[model samples]
Each structure stands twice: as structure tokens, then as C-alpha cells.
Target: MVDWAAYTLVFVAGLITALATGIGALPFFFVPDISEKFNVGLWGVASGIMMAASIFGLIPEGLNAGPWTTVAVGLVAGGLLVLVANDLLMDADIDSRTYEEADFKKLVLILGVLTVHSFPEGIAIGVSFAELNLGSGIPLLGFTVPALAIAMTIAISIHNIPEGVAISIPLRTMGVAEWKMVWWSIFSSLPQPLGAVIAFGFVQLAEPLLPAGFGFAAGAMIYLVLSEFIPDALEAGEELDGKGYRELVAGFAAGGGAMVLLLVVV
Candidate 1:
């Protein structure tokens, strides 16, 4: 009994996050110049939001659904998934320029790298919707949407904005058109809908694995925040005062605190 309607709704929710990435690129449309200080802050903000979502939303939810051991296993497995993917693609570096200019074979390679980047967010969206319409939640359109699902979706969508800014930075350096920057930002996240559908279908069938699923998504997401986002922020802030540590911390506190508040509400 595949609930096509639910699947469609979830996919659309995921797509909304993907589209939100485009919003990051929108600032370039208005101004040809954006300060590096602002860029560092943007990365810091995105990292904070991601870290908070994983810590507050995903892990606790996993614990509530099942034993800590199951969540631990999922977390370890998720980290390993990222580790292995990075190891495989260690020599292959893809950047915004590569995104715009890559031909067929090159395109395939970059997409593989991006899978490691984006799929976990999709999984997060999917697992949050595990209960879907079966439990009490907010009604939207015609379906009873889970509150966690809505929270996770918004969290990811907001995080994607700064991520879009990061992506647009290099493209801006190359003078890529504003619309193309937005398109490429969205393109990077296109797999999310499929990832969401797959995770949703899997959890729906194996209800027992819900905790592990939550752990898996949380683990991957947090790993990314640590390994990728934080480092990127630091690298961007290398020339800034205090090496941008103050800005990073400030952004982290703001982003995490905001998500915590949202979690409290929903």
C-alpha cells in the first residue's frame, strides 16, 4: 500500500528545500559585490543550524523511537558511509567551476561526490516523516503532516540558503550569471527528493528500524557539519580578524538557539 499522495507531498517538501538553495544566490542578483566577512558569517550560520538540527531534532527523536544502541549503530554507519565516500573520491576535487563546465563523464563523477553531501539531509527529511498521518500533527493541504517533518524541512531549507551562498561564491568569482548560480545551487540538491522518497518507503516498510534510520540521518548530517562546514567557514575566515572564530561562534549560537526554540515550539 504505497501512499502515493504522501510520497508526493514528501518529495515536494524536499524540493522546496532544494529550491531554497537558490535563495542564497539571489543576493548576487542585486549586488555584484558581497563582503567576505558576510560570506564567513553565512557559512557559520549554516553550520550552526545543521549542528543544532542533528543534536536536538534527530538524535533525541531517535532515542525516543528506540534504544540508544540502535541510534549509535546508525550514527556509526552514517559516518562510515561518508568516510568511505570521501576516501573513494579523495583525489577528485569538484568546485563551482567544475559544476558549470563539467561534461558527461565529469558530471557523473561530481554527482557521486555530491551524493555524499546531500543524501543525508534527504534521509533526515524522510525519517522525520516516519509517523506521517498516523499521529496527531498539523494539517496542510489535505494531509496531516507530522510536526517533526515540518521542522526538519524548514531547518534544512534555511541551512541551504547559506550553502547556496557558499556555492555562489566561486561562481561569482568566475562571473557566472545570477540565474545560473541559482540553477546550479538547486541542481546540487536535486537528489534530495529521491533520497526522501527512498528513506520514507524504507521506514514505512520496516517500522522497527526507525531509530536506526533517525541515527543514520543525524550521524551523517553532524559529520558533515564538523568535517565540511566548520572547516569551510574557518578557511573562508582565515584573513578575517580573530581568524573569524568569534563570528563562527556567534553564528553557531544564533543558528543552534533558533532551531532549539523552533524544536520547543513544534
Candidate 2:
């Protein structure tokens, strides 16, 4: 029989990451405007955390679970999916940067496009929990919690805060309520739970494809950092003297350091 308890725990873990996005909008509740430097830093922080998570967390686990060839195939496939999705979004004239201003229909379209990116993050969370309750994990709340699962959950949650801020900026300018900003930010990541369940189910059933799962998530996130996150930071900081590259680097270093610290602890 399938362990519903384990499934529920995993789902909850994924949900936690989704909810953490709301924390980003909490600043808007108090402040009228966030500084551009801070915004750029947030993006840089996200980039750093994601890069570390993929290189140190996901890829290593994938290699341990399966061969490097399997991981490589998954990496290529993951990046390719993002590339195709980006083209589709461009052709559709759906600019994710300005999605907060979208109407209902456009919002739906944006969410659909966002799934391509968010799904991999969810998958990363799910794949990390592949060893849950497998008799070789830390005991927690009546379950054997995999250390990797905890680490990924924390990493993704932290990574998502900046995304929430990004989503909220346009909304804040449009005079959207702070509460709504939080809701919209969470909405952007709503697909995570579903993605988590699907990936977890696949890995649990097939067992052999776990490495591919890791690679796919890692590849997708790394591609997004390069293609979207960094550019967004640069664009936002364009008015500054050095295009905010220094802030980005500083944020990246901080984020990377944080994740590395977590890795060491776990």
C-alpha cells in the first residue's frame, strides 16, 4: 500500500516553499517602495542559492543515485524545455516581467507559461524526498526525514522570497493591496505542490529515473538563473553606475554562502 502519510508530508513540504513566497511581499505592507539596489540583490541572492543547490545538492545526489550520462541527458532536456517555453512566451507577447498587470486571461496564460519554470523547482523538492521513510534518515514528526529533503525545502523557500518581491513590485506600483500582492506571489508558485506530487510518484514507482529527476530540476533552475534571473537584475539596475553588478555579486555571495552553510550543517 502507498504511504499516505509520507505523501502528505512531502506535499506539505512543497506547500511550505510555495507559502514562503508570501514573505517577500510582507515588505510592501510597511514600505511604499523598495530600493532598486535591494531588488537587484534579491535576484542575485536567488541566483546564488539556486546555483549552489543545483551543483552541490541536486547533481551530487543524482550522481549517487545513477550514472553521469543519465544526469547529462536530463540536464539537456531540462534546459531545452525552458528555451522552448521562452520562445512560446515571446511569441505570445506574454512578458513575465509585467505579469502583475495582466488581465484575467493573460494571467492564466502567464501562469501556464510559469509552470514550465516552477514545475522543475517543485520536482527538485520532490526528488529530494525520494528517500523519505527509507530507514536511513533523521527522525522527525513520526517520519524518517531525509536530510536532502529538508535542505532542498529550505533552499527553495529562501530562493522564492525574491521572486515574490519581483512579482509584487509591479503590483505595488499599480496600487494593488499588499494582501493581494502576497496572494499573487503565492499564486505564481501554486503549481509547485502538484509538480511535487507528480515527481514523487514517478520516482517512487520507477526508482531508476531518480537521477533524471534531479538533473531535470537542476538544469531547469540553472538555465532560468542565466536566462531570466540575472538579466532581470541587470535590467532593474540599469540606471545605476555599474548596472548593479556589484549588488548582484554581493547578493549572490551571500546566498551562496548561506546555502553552503546549510549544506555543511546537514
Candidate 3:
């Protein structure tokens, strides 16, 4: 009973978002350099969007689908995964920000480690599309795409822009070409399409795990924001003389507001 067409569509949606990450690097083509304060602010916005998507979109949907305990467990497990990934990355001396410095093997190793974070985001997108064509939902490409699916896709795509910038920043500093920066940014999220397809398949096969899946995605994203995004932003803006905090707050507000607006309109 699998709808291969819908599955392909979902995968494409995820892939599009992943590709959107490359667009973040486009700014560097026009500007000689972007300010550190703005970069930190962008991270703040990404953090806010991820947190909002997790809290407002993912968790509530999860609760509606299954038991509280299931969601709680998934949340904790997702957070722990991020924590462990961070430890591993630190030990390996392979943060995404410094990808240019890594040798080929280390580059591959870091990308593999990043999948721990990116794959869950893909899962979140895939799982959101579970109800495609089953009931009343937004119309897209001859299918009844769920509103949540659309929202999640947009949220994740927007959140990814800052990530692309983060990756591009270091490469830019290393004197890499603008085009290469774009390629590297897209490469960072390349796992998303595979993750989306796999998650979609799993959920379709075992409907009961849907709620836990939501929790897992939500937890991973929120934890990533708190543990990685904010800290990185602070570090980037360290020399900004208290402007970092202000930018963080402003960016958070803008991101959250934009997400809420998207949800409301959609």
C-alpha cells in the first residue's frame, strides 16, 4: 500500500531544503565580508526557529499521536545523542566550522558524525508527511500534503541557511572559493534526503512509532540549538561589546515571530 509517488515527493521536499543551505553562501559573492555581529545574530535566529519548531510543532503533534512517556523518553534520548556527538567531534578535532582544515579522511569522519544531527531533522520532515493524501490537507503537487509537513519543511530550510553560513564562514576565512563554499554548505546537509526517505518508510510500516519519532526529532533539534547554536553565536560575537546578547534576543524574537506567522498563515 505504499505510495511511491508521494514518497518521492517527500524526499524531494527534503532535498530542496537541503539545497537551500547552499543559498546561504550566496551572500559572500556580493559582500567582501559579513560582520561577526550579523553572523551571530543569524545563529540566534536559527536557534529560535529550531526551538519553536520543536516546542510548538513537533512536541504537540507527538503528544497528540501517543503517550507522554514515549515522547519524554524520545526527547531525552535525542538530547543525549547531541551531547555524545559533541564529545566525539571534540575528541576528533572535527567541528563543522573547521571543515576546511581537515584532511580527506577527517572530513569524511566529521560528515558522518554530523549525520547524527542532520538525519533526525530529515526524519522530522518525513514523519510529518505521513498523512499525505489520507485526509484533508494542503494541496501541493496533486497530493494532499499535511500543513505540518509544509511548515516543518520551511522551518528546517530556513534554519539551515544559518548553518550553511556557519560552514561557509570558516572556509571563506581559509581562502576557499565562493562556489566551493556553496558546495560545502550543501554537502553538509546531503544526508537529509536519505534520512527523509528512511523515516517515511519506517513510519508507514509501523504507525505506532509516529509519536516517538516526532519527539526524537524535536528533542534533537532543540538540544542542538541550546548546545551548539547559542554557544557558537556567543563565541562568534565575543568581541562585540555586549551587542551579541542584544542581537541574540532580537534574532530570537524575529525567528520565533516568523515561524509563528508561517504557521498561522499556512
C-alpha RMSD by candidate, in order: 5.1, 4.8, 4.9
Error of 3 at 105 (Å): 13
Provide the TM-score for each candidate, comma-separated.
0.66, 0.69, 0.68
| After superposition, candidate 2 runs with Cα above 4 Å error | 1-14, 24-28, 93-177, 188-206
**Candidate scoring better on TM-score of 1 and 3:** 3
Query: Weakest 10 consecutive residues, lDDT, candidate 1?
Result: 102-111
Per residue, candidate 2 scores C-alpha lDDT tens digits across 55-140 of 88778867987899998888887788677766665556444563342333334433343445566678777878888888688899
lDDT (tens digit, per residue) of candidate 1 on 30-102: 8866576766676666667666777887789779878999999998987776666555555455554443533
Tell me model 3's lDDT, rounded to 2 decimals. Answer: 0.73
Off by over 4 Å in 1: 1-28, 93-177, 188-192, 195-206
Candidate 2: worst 10 consecutive residues by lDDT?
101-110
What lDDT does each candidate get? 0.73, 0.74, 0.73
RMSD to the native, candidate 2?
Answer: 4.8
Candidate maximizing lDDT? 2
When 1 and 2 are scored with lDDT, the better candidate is 2
lDDT accuracy of residue 179 in candidate 2 = 96
